[model samples]
Target: MRHLHIRTPRRRVIGALAAGLLCTTGLAAPALAAPTAEPAAPTLADGLALTPPMGFNNWNSTHCRAEFNESMVEGIADLFVDKGLKDAGYQYVNLDDCWALPARDADGKLVPDPVRFPHGIKAVADYVHAKGLKLGIYTSAGTKTCNSAGFPGALGHEYSDAQQFADWGVDYLKYDNCNNQGVDAKLRYTTMRDALKATGRPIVYSICEWGENKPWEWASDVGHLWRTTGDISDSWGSMLSILKQNLPLSAHAGPGHWNDPDMLEVGNGGMTDTEYRTHFSMWSVMAAPLLIGSDLRKASDATFDVLGNKEVIAVDQDPLGKQGTVLSSEGGRWVVAKEMKDGSRAVALFNETGSPQHIATTARAAGLPEAGAYTLRDLWQHRSYNTAGTIAATVPAHGTVLVRVSAGGRWATRPPAVELGLDGSPLVQAGRTAALTSKVTDLGRTPATHLSVTLAGPAGWTVKAISPTTAGLLPTGRSLRTKWQVTAPGSTATGSYDLTLRARYRSLTGTRVESVLPLKATVVVAPPAGVSSLGDLPWLSTTNGWGPVERNTSNGESAAGDGRPITLGGVEFAKGLGVHAESAVEYYTGAACETVTADVGVDDEKGARGTVAFEIWADGTKVASTGVLTNAMPAQPVTADVSGAQVVRLVVTDGGDGIDSDHADWADAKLMC
Candidate 1:
């Protein structure tokens, strides 16, 4: 079911998951405080969505196709009850896009498409209710919906539309942001919230702004569930992308307000069955709204299995409603833990890498009570594990191990930590062998001995490598460096290849426990074409964030973004903007060609926030700039007039909102005549 799909805003291509998150934009300009009660609250939130909403959304699976009719809705409603999805808590039968008529009726009221919904929306809602289910509708805050759906948005029609939906027995509303014309996000959203409140409807208001303007900061009082990231597609990469975007905002999610990572992509075939389970597990742990976006009429068995994991669903529906968070990340493994209402914890060992990995952590390390043994239950396999102080798991490539730990038992002794990292640049050009040194450090008191390093190249590609063989004793707090000669094949593809690096060592303590640090080397193959990519831009660096220099060939993260696209220049570039949001890129206007041009815009995916200016610097002086960009504007084609500058310094800065949603992007950024 497809309609006129606009470019999905070319959202960020998520790279590594960052270990930390930026709580606030430390822009030099003070952020304006959230609106106060003197202006009166905009909407009557009234504690809706006490838990993340469990339902079905039509956008991801069937987007405004001719099949998007009342029967389709009724068919899904029947599946909800027949297939036990309703039993597991999925209730809403939603109409996402294309259900609205081309225009409002004579009284400016939204009318259902006559051909598609010959019986009208009220009749459909009544049918859903008859099946013991709820109904949800989709609209936009802008002038029009995000699809070719002919109905006008609820911008000026919010109150009347809200009343109309209420009268039609609608129980949910997904308000989107398209054709919004860059109006102040807070004001516009608040307007619709008040309009819904005026109708005295108990609708679950879902804000679909796609994380622009930092909705988490101000939407707690506005909507029940607000999208904290871009849309989700039925692919592992897209799911992980949305997951990483919403995970760090865990603190803002709760009983009444949850971080919406958009609709679910499970049951879709873009990902494998295992990957689908991982997708559902992570979303459940994050306490995100579980809106199934698949056609139920022809659901697959694997889809049913992933969606019907009642034990996992219990974690999501726990009355405590506390969203899980990443407790510890080592190598490519993450130990995510969530507290349950019954003093229990749901822990997920997630392996984000493409290789099988062994990840172990103590209860204390994962934020559990330092001194208690926990009864662990395997949620997926439906088995129980022996009470233990430590959880050591071997996760498959891009897989997960989710378990529930019951509190109150024995105490655990903290384990030693060994860190393995590369000493030189992680990026290597094709055909060149680089001296890759692995720095192994003992962060704990346990002495390490008999250390060895192993390296593996990409599969199917022959890589010439001379790795370090053996090492002697390394006392606690001591560090050792081993060198490896790694050469990529001359004909290697121009992309990022993970070089598997494993450090094996034994604890020289009385117990003599062995440990292995699974790390990967990210080598960026320069395009055989010769022009440097945006990430490889000579002087591209940011003025913010901590640097593990989260760099790849495409996107990177400086400390500020916390694994988010490098936020800088008053915009978050899903491309690699380095360090902080106020950084600059240095390049020759004639580096690889004649002129350096890029389509620049705020990183708000669509309508970027705040005012941003792009400045071109010459020898210690400013030359050209696209003044301060107004709020909610589209990306402008900016060609810098670097008249006589040799090494041009491109600078971008936040115009006040303290770099709020100022993720600037330079799409198709290149140097050309």
Candidate 2:
């Protein structure tokens, strides 16, 4: 779902009227009137999606696999009711692709896939409606869909398909852009808009054009929502990139139309819980769609907690429908504020760096009126405090603190804010110990009494306090620091484990309050002391634009083991890694590797159609890079200095053009210790 195209901003032209003299012996001539006003841009006028649509889509969790059947769809509908999502404003249960047969029926009508939908699409839609929910379907604006399977689409059959959807009780349509036959984007989308309007059924239209045509400039009148960036993957880099792309277009979003950055990946397990919270908070602040894109059946309690946060959801569903604006952003620290319907401001302090940072912003800066005092409510912590118009927090890396600020509220005591940290890397060997720290600060107006902090790890792991873990009293603007040594058992598996930090204290009114923060620890094995092929080692994490990164092969199709011998510019090698553009593979070196060497270039499998660049990073610093390599060039040797580096990352990015066919190869990549 990636696209690249240049777009010129549309402009309005005005004509000047000239007056004639007495050439014909005439007196004063009548003045020329201004041209008639242009007609208003066409809007849906359906009064739908006044707030960003809240729902679920199956593509992210189950794509066109066998698990995406009627049973699964019905099960999700049931979970939406049982898991309190329905009550929380999630309404639609949608299907993305591969829902219909490959060909049209005798009357040129789309036929439901019997194997996927036993009783047909209508039966499933009826089931969803019975649960007081709605159903949505997907189709492309071309002759075929995006998947390699190539299902039938609705390009030349807009009216017929619209009627069929209305008759089948469909309430929403997600029209995509693939194989579009080079048609004008506005014309294609407007045609469907007219077709849907003629059906007399209120169907939400989602334009999925991947922002190639600058839809934000004209799509507000055509679709209820439009995709504002490329597809999203479950990685920190992917989420951050998309966020940057969508944030600058805030002026184009409002009530009835939204800028979509794709669906949620909170429970996908590719990132930590802290990162997921940041993802949810940013999306809500931007007033983006709140579509759940994970499998609810296997979702964890932590995932549900993030998705079911009512206060955050309120910011997204606010009746004012104003998207948050960036107050300040510098040095990976950001402050964003959204105007709410209740005359309050929703402020978010976000930290995108690799360490904690203190971000600050005043009420006036956030678009709020002057008052004696402002009430700041921490949406995630569910606490309120009275402040003299100052909103600030020491946000953790990849974490966000969301607060609602309003004027003229009763002064009340609030709980102290606590931050957790690790002295060194979170990675540890089995039977090894690590140092953990905590800082509890009383930001309220009064003192906190009987303050105590404790660190707890998983069962069978030991935690011992290295410093005083309790305090009798903590005054305002004062902090209490505590440290602990956590040891993992020898039998512990090589994976991530959760550690919890708990703090308890009495407020000004002598009411006991408690706060808990979750932390992640990873156990990894160090590489052997010798030169070895990188393909033989385990990667800490990987994110590729297409399928999984291949081992010991060339970039082939988008499937594991589908590659052939490692080939670059007609030269073949026996061992290497194959990846697509916009890819990253990270490995834990534990500061043991001395150097890394590789032959990098665009894979020959794509002929002369790809352009990409290769980069090597050590401990967040770029060590070496191949500026730009194309399929027309030969393989180039690259060497990177990795001395005293704990981690090494290999990256492939699209080279100026786009990621159309940027299949890249890392031939004979080796790490020497």
Candidate 3:
């Protein structure tokens, strides 16, 4: 049960137990180790600097394309140092995967892809270091890298690989969980951790195992930072998904170890500038690593502003180093807070929903300054306002208002982008037959308000006694009281049906402040009378890696290509919000299991190859994987299976990458029980 331990300048030793861990092994003694000397066995402090990591990765910018190259790296490093990013606490010019060729030398050493990085890794590292930026590289714990450009894996050569990185002058290593499988997930990382330490090069160990085995628990003792979510894309869906994933694990970050929500997609044009600001603000509040993924050499003004928000950067680089978490969320609004040094705090009001609304909550609601009135400062707009008691502001649609708070007094202020929320919760879910009652109040003293309620039920369901469906109503006074007799559908799913309520209030000046409430009511729909089975079949698929697999490939292949690992799509399950149902997949890439299937279709030809395999607990466990060995010319569908299996996966080893799968087009895939 390892937990994150924060070392505040005040209570030098806040946790006696952590103090014991520190004392028991002199963990904090090597902070100023000689950089040029033999690497002090790598530690969390070694992986991440006293400051959060700041660097440019190729993922968001190049997306595993030909765009990631030596010139790109050289240009970004120059801008990083020139723009004072390094001086302002940015370091680490990291080159993600795909830089290495698929072939290994006789010594089992990974070779740089001569076509992409013709000058070799040493030259690349020299280039970055010459720019006063540290050089970081990527690898995997398994036999292959996620990109499938078979870099020398740390699997059987952890020690040798670590030494090789040290020899290459690689200052950071993002050791990912590629081919490693089974219950030994941590061991796989631990093996590399120890190996990197043995090199004594002071290489910052970046654990990229994708949040498996709760790396936040002890990874701080091993690596500098750990990715708490699966890899993130530069799209809104991917960014939102990753941010939502980082919300719950907030408490696990502190000091030396930080939760990595993947790289920055700011300035990448995948999302709007406002959305990127929200992304940066939210990540800062989460105390996440600020690795830039966009091409900095040609960043937009908005990107520069977002990446250079001094106030927001302060929160991310706060000495508190404490990660923030979600306090509450409703409709399209979410409130999150981070405890800061000097007992001050930072709160973020996020609007992810459509339509503009006021998102309001108090200090206590933010999990800080409990029971006391505090002054608030808007970090974004740099404004200050003294609320009579509790603080409130009106947020805009798909926007955010960040408030910084201290014990007392006001600070320099600017125009605030105010947002507000309901102080009291509306009637969430009363039994369908039970009467519904709710009280909505305004924190901004807005005048008479209007409220609307919308309810959706089982298929072909209806509510006979309801107010206007597509309309609005004014409130009686400072609050609104409402009630309705709700009836349940006879064939209801016997689960919870979401009920949404939107309240609109007008300020004294007649400005509208809208707030939404979302709750769930359970109907008495009965479940099946007997036990159920999901069946034995392909349960998961990932491209170019492991898990339920589908054919995957990089379009970089000329006639000079051979083979690559099949990376598959990763999945996680949680509650569904009507669009994509969240299903928690227990499988992370590194595990082996039985039974498999893939939902695949081909588009173009080229050398298309895919495989599916599973594992049983014992040796007799049957396993199978299949693929088209040559240029299929056209796309085709395929499947494979085995008997006596526990987990399964499908994969495509070559042909193409990204949305346009050169080898094939993937629709959807799943594994059976």
Candidate 4:
């Protein structure tokens, strides 16, 4: 499923440390190079937070201005206690951005805005702690916060700022990605994680990168929770969009790490009561952070009913912390199930349509334990039903029917030791190939065998083993490896593509099971580099060229209008600048690119009679040009020093001659970057 960018954009991949494979000759092949160590699962404050955090933030409600002062936060802290929210488990009072002054003080320490916090952040921290609630603050990975208010961010001052936060009794930090310096999410986030750990004050590090770099795949150990989508708006569409983006990422969430689909907008009035119910239910199932983004001082009773649902909050705060799984979805109805720490199961029948719908699923099919009779308790309706088979419920449109299915009273037996783990780079460049590898570790008493591995990728893609080997015949205490090579065409654009890995095998107890792991990888394909053809580069505009906006390599036309590969886009130009006919393609230079070159000509098939010259441009300035040629002349060359040039344009212009049959072509054009 394609995910919406939501918050910001950005990732390539780095993986866990693993020994590189050595060939029969004891030499490591270049293709199987080892990757850099990726962000390890954090151990700081290890075992501290075991479930999705429940809290209140100021951004979504107050927009982070002067009105969002200490009084508001204090009121929220008070409301959590008064409305049974604190007793039911919502504890954090988070201030999201705009609480600090524009710049650091003379000591380089961040200063709280005097007008807003009057008594300083330390005083506010004491007020929240007095009520048994934790205090959380916000910062950005960049030099400044998201707003022009200019609160000093946690960039160059990570360690010092972390120490200051610790001194102020800060329990959590919501680190955002605003004005970010294009740093990799892993690098920037892990830096703060380390800084927080160094402070010796257990702060729950929240990574708010806006899901640009597919944080779910790389941010598991970098922070307590990572935002998997963009900032949430109060609108129904925005909330639903974020919810959908976080659906498939449940496998990565557990005890310490959580996937945050931005803060909640439930009591904020952007959505109706039904839509609000669906939002809360979905977030609970996904184990997403339940941060209230509404003003507590004036919250309506209806808001209190939704926000104070103890049963629903209990499911969200379930100690097991496993993200809910979508068991089935048909005709806009979905049945999602989350395993509770107590061994019971939390199931939700959601109606995504606008009208009411009949949603149902069998207990076993919903992944509930023990395929037998179970009692279901409706969380929202506060009703109970004893059923032995299918659990059915009619759900209102844009609403949910949440229930707790009894685990039949006890937990099931644990499985044996054999398991499957996948390790591979999630990137594949166009016109190039990469490898995908899987490993099986056996630690059980039985000797397992007859294992099968299957792989699948996007359409127009190819996958096969680099070298064939025996098909899974391993024993106890043994490890085996499987590999495949993946390739795509140069014309392939950059996008997210999943390379699904599945393994099936029999365990020592004669039980057969299939393990499916989602390995996230993106296909990044760029234009030709290092003395490549110009035709291969994508055109910026065709009106600026001679023919249709694209290149014409085939269609019985020649590269350079003769018979070559220069016409990659199959674009045939008829004239040049004289007849108002022109064509150009932009290429990049500097660092990787040193030179830009091209072959220009008129096709032999069309009397190719036009005054044409080849030209090279650098950042809008004409850098070089070739002699004029008319009639069906030989293809001329256009070469210029493209070193340090950011944008290189290749142009074919009509000479002094008026275009008659001036079919022109620029073949074999390429950049050295």
Which candidate tops TM-score?
Answer: 2
Model 4 / residue 384 / CA error / Å: 1.5
Model 4, span 350-432: residue lDDT tens: 87543345567777876766654566676886744444545665455467878887745321221223334445234567788
Residue 258 accuracy (lDDT) in model 3: 75
Arrange candidates by TM-score, descending: 2, 1, 3, 4
Q: TM-score of the candidate numbered 3?
A: 0.57
Q: Give the 10-residue window scoring lowest on summed lDDT in candidate 3.
A: 22-31
The global C-alpha lDDT for each of the candidates, from Candidate 1 onward, is 0.63, 0.77, 0.54, 0.64
lDDT of 3 by residue, 1-673 (tens): 0112310001111221211111000000001111122222333655245556777677666746787888888888888877777776778888877788777789888788887888998998998888778998887777766553345556888888888889989998887765563427677788888998888788877787666556776676778888766555554544565566567666567776777878887887767676688889998998888888788878877788788787888889998777776666654468788888868778888875322346677766665544333566778766454332355554543467787876544321211112323222121222345455444543321223334444433344444434342223332223344554556655454344655555554433444545454444444321122221212221221122111122232222211132232222322111110011011121211123233344333322222432211111111122332333222332233344433332222223221111112233332333332
Worst 10 residues of 1 by lDDT: 18-27
**Of 3 and 4, the candidate ranking higher by lDDT:** 4
Best candidate (score: lDDT): 2
Cα error, residue 359 of model 3, in Å, equals: 1.0
Task: Kindly list the per-residue Cα lDDT of model 2 for residues 1-673, writing each as its tens digit.
Answer: 1111211110111121101100000000111222223322445667999999998998777767889899999999999999999998899899988899999999999999999999999999999999999999998877777665677878899999999999999999998876577678788888999999899999999998777677877888999999876667666655665666677667777888888988888897877798899999999999999888899999999999999999999999998887887777765578889999999999999876544566788889999899766678889988876666667776766789999988766656444333334444467678988776677776555667898988888899988999998889987667788877888899888877877777788866777878666566777788889999988888866666565789998757655788889898888988889887667777789889899999999888776577778888886677888887888999999999999988788887666433546678899999998
The lowest-lDDT stretch of 10 consecutive residues in candidate 2 is 20-29
Q: Per-residue lDDT of 1-673 in model 1, one digit per residue for the tens?
A: 0112432322322222211111100111112233222321232349778888998977676665787798899999999999999999987888886787878878899988899999999999999999999999988887777664335778787788889999999999988877676677788888888888888878898888777677877888888878876566554544554565566677677788888887777876667677788888999998988889788787888899999999999989888978887776544477788888987788898875444455566666656675434556779877553344566565655678888876553212322345555553344556777666766665443456777666667765444435545567766556677667777777765445656656676644433433333334444422223334455454422332112223321123222224445333344444443322343554433322435566665544323344556665553355556766744666577665544443455555544323333445554455442
Better of 1 and 4 by lDDT: 4
Question: Given candidate 1, what's the lDDT at residue 39?
Answer: 22
lDDT for model 4:
0.64
